[model samples]
Target chain A: MALAASGPSERGGGDNLLLATFLEKRENLVLFLAARLRSMATAEDLIQDLYLKVAAMEPGADVRAPAALLYRMAANLMVDHVRSAQRASRRDAQWRLETRVTLGSLDVVSEPAADDALVARQRVRLLAEAVAELPPQMGRAFRLHKLEGRSQAETAEAMGVSRKMIEQHISAAVRRLAERLRT
Target chain B: MTQDGLARAQAAAWVVRLGGDATGEDGVEFDAWLQAAPGNRAAYRRALVLWCEFDARAGDVLAELTAVGAQASARPPAARRSASRLVPPAGRRRSALRWLTPIGGFALAAGLALAVLPPTVLKPATSTTYATGRGQHQRVALGDGSVIDLDAETRLRVTIAGSERRVALAEGQAIFDVVHDARRPFLVQAGGRTVRDVGTQFDVRQRAGELTVTVARGRVEVGSDGSGQPVLLGPGQRLQVDRASVSQLSVVDPAETFSWRAGRLVYRAQPLADVVADLNRQFVEQTVIADPELGKLPITGVIVLDNPRAVMTRLSLMLPIKAVPSDRGLTLLRK
Candidate 1:
């Protein structure tokens, strides 16, 4: 529906239309997130966050196209999260190898049978091989983030790079791993 | 598409798949990039399907990985030493292999399986009934300030909220003098399609899957849930939307629609079955037809909704029919 630009009296009409559209399109936006996040619950949470952001926006400000603006905002939020995760991963790796030998010295005994252990070792070997095949920086970011559990900011600091760069690295890492694991 | 265009599409798909929880300005750039090309939208949709497939199997993969990790940890010190040795000094080389190989296999299978399955379908809402017996005209003020004047033997439910205001008519009829609230558009969901209010007064009546909406003032938008398209009705227009079909809009007398709220039931060539259906709600025992064909006979007049028996007597005087109590319910037959 084309929104007519009229006097202040007609502003109410515009607001009503906008609110209606928002309600109708909110689910579509959530579906958009769920497709990417792979988790409906997480997507729902993000939609809630988006709702708060959208609701708080100044109404008087001219939103030339509400749908496009909403999508743009949602996209920016996702990118920021990816970047932070990247940074966290890098920092985690440095911490794991440098200050974490306690697990190595543990005297825990095994409970599982030999066959299970053998199978596990093989899986880890497969996983290791996959990571090894990743592009250098991307692989490092994934390890520090996923395996080591470092904060994205810390990972970025350890890598001595911008947070955005770290996110890009992780995204590439995940894509490559997802592709490689398929075979 | 160019490699750069493809990359951006992939990134956008990831952002959406992640539920937009990812950080950085890449999501914004990715969105802009996706909109930049029609090809990008198509690629993103493909990636989205793959992402959903991977997501469904994420639980299984995580469980398997945890089991593997536990197994690795349980091994003797010597085995861990050998495993650690296999990890190259360059962490990058090791990480690439760690995530790529196993995850890729499961994700691809899961994606293909999910794609082959049909999309999920949502079931229609189960209806709840609200009815008033014969000879009783009740006025109900809804939560949203809209008032409903239920004619005798009418059944309806009012569901109102900030997001949506809906009324489901099970049987009988009601006159709605709806309060104007733009934020919450009022609608009567009955007979598959919804009679949506566009800041107007209207009356809706439903009987045996046959329903009608009469707009006295303002406008109404009528459309089925499956079809998003709506037919808008202006003031003084009456439309019949039923399971069988929707009738052409006819200019109606606004008073004829509002007469029920004023304690009078007005009928114009309406069936005996419909008149009895209206009476059943206003009266406890209800009027029934002895002959099946008699129920289909038409009647046209104004019945002052007062005493149930009095209305029935008046109805019998106008038509050659007499009311009789049967084992099932009240019955009416030719005199």
Candidate 2:
């Protein structure tokens, strides 16, 4: 089946206008779902599910605002299906994480190539070094919020700062990390 | 700003916006922003890649960060620069519980430790590394009277830091007869899982990618360093964990499992590949399965740690398999 077709010409825009808009914002939707679900892998699957639902849709009349309807369907799908999917995927992810041959102390006989693992380990080291190089406030906020997986409010409480300030620090830290590591 | 820089900045913004407790309206705006231009989407995708990569390797990064933070903390405050310095976060507030402590038993264990500590403080850190080459066996007696027997091709690092007696098993297997110290929790970290004991005799084997912990005497808790329910194993209980999942506990004769200490490799319905792997570590000549299907064949019974050729001959008699000498090692094939 044709999973996707480019947005129809302007004359036929209304037919799959919602799908077109959804496609444009597909990455954003995945990110949104990822935030809610705490897993990008699960978010990606849900997006595919959403795509199937949209693809199988029968041709309909002109829609006034497709974005609103698209999100409505997306939200409904998440409420109905994604919650259970999230739980199941979490258990699956746990098993996956358990089985992954990380660069831990164990000598995994069937692990990835040594060079590949060393490169990834080196990247991780670089990321840590970048985090260490961040401005003190940004570094502390990032260490508490991202690296330590603390809630913004909790991090704020720990650092004796407002949650808004923590958010700003995190945003700046993300920007800085992206700038530093993209190269 | 360069287009790349602008894209990265936009990507970073999206990450924060999407990652935060975003409402439906924020999602709509994000979608609109993504639709407005192809560059936005590409930029966000770039950021997402980094975001996801970091998420996948968060454990390694945090461990490295912690190590760095620990070192930085040891240095004088005036000597450190504020811009590049970072302290441990609040989430890991309880450093004493840094290693694995089984769920529900944390309180009980901590309470026990409180009552067990001596009036005198523990000594400074004394780190030791123990390793055994192929066909070699070594036994180590720690300062605390705990003895460890290292099997062939094993590498283990031991450190007595303050009240914690920690050992990191990098490869191979070891039988730890730990002297119980209520105050000093004996922890063995291997393959992202920790085996913690106050006093116990346990066999921990990290062969290939699988980690097997068999408790012989007393009780020991095995759990992932990541948040999960830690399992407590009693004597005669074995927990076998491959990289992917933890196998159900099998009632094993600790002696049979520990027979490797006496140079006898015992197997009970283990795959031929695993047996071959163990043999590869013990002998200089590697054993390779020519037919992939033959590797899955289950082989049972005891195989003495004799020379590779003799062992392969003995194996050939039991299974419909023959060994051919390859350029590098011995390859097993179906007869």
Name the top lDDT candidate.
2
What tier of docking accuracy does candidate 1 attain? incorrect
Error of 2 at B88 (Å): 19
Question: B28-85 in candidate 2: lDDT tens per residue?
Answer: 6777677666687777766666766666665456555644443332222341234322
* lDDT, candidate 2, at B132: 72
lDDT: worst 10-residue window of model 2 chain A: A90-99
Q: Candidate 1, residues B190-236: lDDT per residue as tens digits? A: 77778888766678877677878888767888887777568888887
- Candidate 2 clashes: the total is 4
Give fnat for candidates 1, 2 and onward, in order: 0.11, 0.25
After the best TM-score superposition of candidate 1, give how far the Cα of residue A35 lies from its true spot, in angstroms: 80
